[model samples]
Target chain A: MVTESDTGSIQVEIIPSRFLLPATAQKLLNEIYGNGGIIRIMIHGPNLPRSVPYGPGRGSPIDENRDLLIEVGGQAFELSVKVGRIRLELESEKYYEGLKAACERALPISFQIRRGKFFHTRQTITDYAKYGKVEDTRILGLIDPKAKQDRLAILSEENVAVHDEER
Target chain B: MAYTPQYYPGSTSVGINRRKHMSGNLEKLRDIPEADVVAVMGHRAPGADYSSTHPPLKEMGEPDCPIRQIVAPTAGAAAGDRVRYSQWTDSMYFAPSIPYWRSYWGAINCKGCDPGTLSGRQIIEARERDIEAYTKAQYDSEMTDVALCSMRGCTVHGHSLRLEENGMQFDMLARTEMGSDGNVYAVKDQVGIPLDRKINLGKPMSEAEAKKRTTIFRVDGIPMCGKVGARKYDEAVDALHHMWELRSKWGFRPE
Candidate 1:
């Protein structure tokens, strides 16, 4: 019942929930980059809850904030997260290795990772109607407004760097 | 001559695991320090002298009874230690131990033990020291995985609930937490009281290890009736059937 035109490139995060915290993800990224390597981190998970449903804390706000401050190697990078998979395609083999290690550490042991095309690699009609522009890369198809506003700045490897030593 | 005892039947991994638990012969996988176990139990503080309800049995002269003289009391009973309990909730998602099996394990292996089996949780009541020892055995043995099982006196959710996105069971009272180092740390007692410091419970089981050690038979993992010899050779089922057929004919007055 599904058609190709209706689909877009997307990612599936098969890992458990605890590892998606910005701080924890940053720690994992730091570990991979610590050993003379350059890599980009892609985070994938369920949609962050927007509200608290019941009890004395009923209707309280959940993780509604789309922006997070990710700290890796003492450096702080402001990342605007969407409700879906955040992909990383970079210029080094270490990036893949780091991504694998981080995922293994973060996800449950029973989950599996598959290699394939998941996200829309091309701009859609929606993008043209909404943004009045076509994205050059396929990774940014179904992103949040904040992520779009940032214009791929958050995904830039230049945003990641070790913090100044004198902290 | 004594006959060899067989604990359970079926060639499936779940059946084997059940036998190992009933037999009390599974190897201990990790060591949670004694004080840590005590802290989590919340009956008494670590190193605190057990509060007694009665004087020592030796000090309190007892009326002569033949059964009392013939059978020995457990260490806690002997010491006149107060009765205490440690309750555990196991995630049905491939947890190494389940409620009914835990009850069976305690009844067969522990002295002066009274194990309560519920739908989602198991509770064992024994004299202070005896229950502590039994609790430690369950915690350290292959029966428990830090992420899949938790000590909860109340608010024992996550049994049927899908594992928290991290595959860990978060005790409702916030008794346990997954540490940044990826190990489980118990910061609260079983009853939701906070401890002075956290106790490290150690690493969780791998997926393969958990599947092999689990007693829960599932279609995705190892189906209960799907195994080669399980349906045909299940000794427990056979025994139950034999009892059931006779019971229908004989009623309660088997004699």
Candidate 2:
């Protein structure tokens, strides 16, 4: 807060309040993380499969192209985007408001935003614990993207490095 | 007694198209060369011999039956050409030749043909040369829009999917690709095997042209409910309703 400056000149301030759709969000993310590595963006919506399910060409391969090969910040990132509901396990409630708003701008229907306990705030009795899981279901994917146990393996599998540079 | 044939009922553009398709009155849109049609069918090379499944009926010397004597075999059967099929997939986005409509066209127009209709695709199986001729007729007719309808024997995925930016229907196997010269080129056969050279199928129909020619009663287009003679209370619907009611009532009666 710029309360009282020594010069006491007419102080001007700017606030970033523009709502972002998927296209705009993509640009914003690219600009913010342009210098290096990867800023994780988990896109959730209508999960369209990359293959045909029925008819004469049943089980035939298709290029759904939902798995986007986006070249952001001059670095190509293959975002394995899925469409679904997200249960936020956020430390701050304010961040959840922004996440909900972002979802609204993209998908206006079939999405419910509510405060709930879902993903673990603290890692314990994990789906896939330090070594491995007792029963790792295939539906949840072979490796959970959120799990910390196979953090390094997940990064390598997705071909992305953690964005750890100072702002 | 002489009989008059009325194809389909309705005063709407869509109904009119259905009538045109069924009556074999669809205007010729393009003339794909016989060689090009063969190339797309991928059954046999252009000018190649038509492989046979059996000897010609005359050569085999069939047993003298009154029925066989009266019913002359088609040219294809007479030549002993093997039975072959042509399958087509029409996109739901105002494609002219819907599955059922395609089958109707083939069943009524093509002789010695067996038409099978699926949800998104339709196939017509006949003697090899006969099928090729039938397929070529459909390809050249207004029933097929190069972008909206495609000959896809298998792996047909674009029936309900969004069209590509170039206005071509989505082909999972990339059977067709749009050329820089504004012509749609078929690079692969119906089953998706790469061809030796591209077959230029010509330009896609304009949005206006497709909407006018489409037989599909879409909400944005000439919806069936809003059409002048095809409305719910229209004679076509009323006739169908009356027939259904009578059929059910008569089922329980001896008369």
Candidate 3:
């Protein structure tokens, strides 16, 4: 288990003026991942439900802006929410300027980068109840514990090298 | 003395816009075809006959009463048309009209109608023909911007959410899409039913235009309590405060 003092990572949140499309999100993610100082990143937005959740059109298929596929750092994942805010844990405060520069290059609209403790440093009772005996502390509060599928997409040099060799 | 109605009180643009809406004196922004409006409403097919609920008022023959003799029936009521409804969801981002203002407009202008206002949506129910007329007027007037305000019967979400990258409101069903031709089009009806053909809603107004025309008060545009440099309550707020004070005082002791 990695303690908070051991890592000494800093958290920052990137908030855009508007929600991003899948293509735009992919571009932003690639830019941030390429910069190579991010320890972990969490995307936040409103859920794009697969079917109509309520009202007269209940259970109807909603094809638009749902189940979008985005590739970042050669890892493709299905995005279920509209990209609104991106919270990143950096190795140190030195990478904050680089992160802002990355956002500037990827986003056409105005954005704000706020420095704060955005992520939960330690697991709570709910996390323990949902995910019994967590082994990886880095992913403590990265995702919704109740979600059936794991939303994490690990991007490492070794994994990329293996993917490139296979290709 | 002839009594003149003052719709609202304020010197800000929002107050002016509210007065314009309440007085039914909005500028016509677009001319969406009658058939297209009908298609988006999804209540009945375009050019189809309006179904009736009862016999014509003249034929039905009301009882001999003073109120009945004085009040004339509306066109739809006279024709014995069934009651129908239209609903709208307006974005929080400087939408031309909000739910409360829309309800106010309906109460002031329309006859024999029920206007319901919710946090994110507003609905009006009236006789079939009258509702169609009201819907068409709202679509064509400056009260609605196609990108920021949309007709939504069910699953009415996205009013308080952030807008899409293209400046359009975030609709989960995506009933409307911005076409490559720089015009908005309705591919699906208000209830998420796919339309037989796309209905072209005119181009959306620019950000500056929407801000100028909107009734909502925002810190970025114009705050309800004046701007940062000059912090003061608007005239409308003062009026409301006066009314509230009188109401509370009267309720506590009626003399």
**DockQ scores for all the models shown?**
0.05, 0.08, 0.54
How many clashes (backbone atoms < 3 Å, residues ≥3 apart in a chain or on different chains) does model 3 have? 0
- Residue-wise C-alpha lDDT for candidate 2, range B1-255, written one tens digit per residue: 898577777677888888889999889989999999998888888899999999998899999899988988889999999999999999888888788999999999989999998888899999999999999999999999998889987776678765654567766666787799989898777876667898999988998999888888887887764464632643445556778999889859565
> Tens-digit lDDT track for model 1 on B1-255?
998567776667788899999989989899989999998998888899998889999999999999999989988998999999999999888999999999989999998899999999999999999999999999999999998999888666658755554567634344577888989888767766667898899989887889989999777898765455543655545665787898887756645
> What tier of docking accuracy does candidate 2 attain?
incorrect
Pairwise lDDT winner, candidates 2 and 3: 3
Clashes of each: 10, 2, 0
- B1-255, model 3: which lDDT tens digit per residue? 998687999888998999999999999999999899988998899999999999999899889999888888889999999999999999999999999999999999999899999999999999998999999999999999999999999878989998999989988888899999889999888888778898999899999999999999888888876545666877877998999999888858555
In model 2, state the lDDT of residue B54. 96
TM-score for every candidate vs. truth?
A: 0.61, 0.68, 0.90
Worst 10 residues of 1 chain B by lDDT: B225-234
Residue lDDT tens for model 1, A28-52: 5565445333323355443332343
Which pairs clash in the backbone of model 3?
none
Global fold similarity of model 3 (TM-score): 0.90
RMSD of each: 11.3, 10.3, 4.8
Name model 3 segments beyond 4 Å from true: A1-7, A124-126, A150-167, B1-3, B226-234
Query: For candidate 1, what is the DockQ?
Result: 0.05
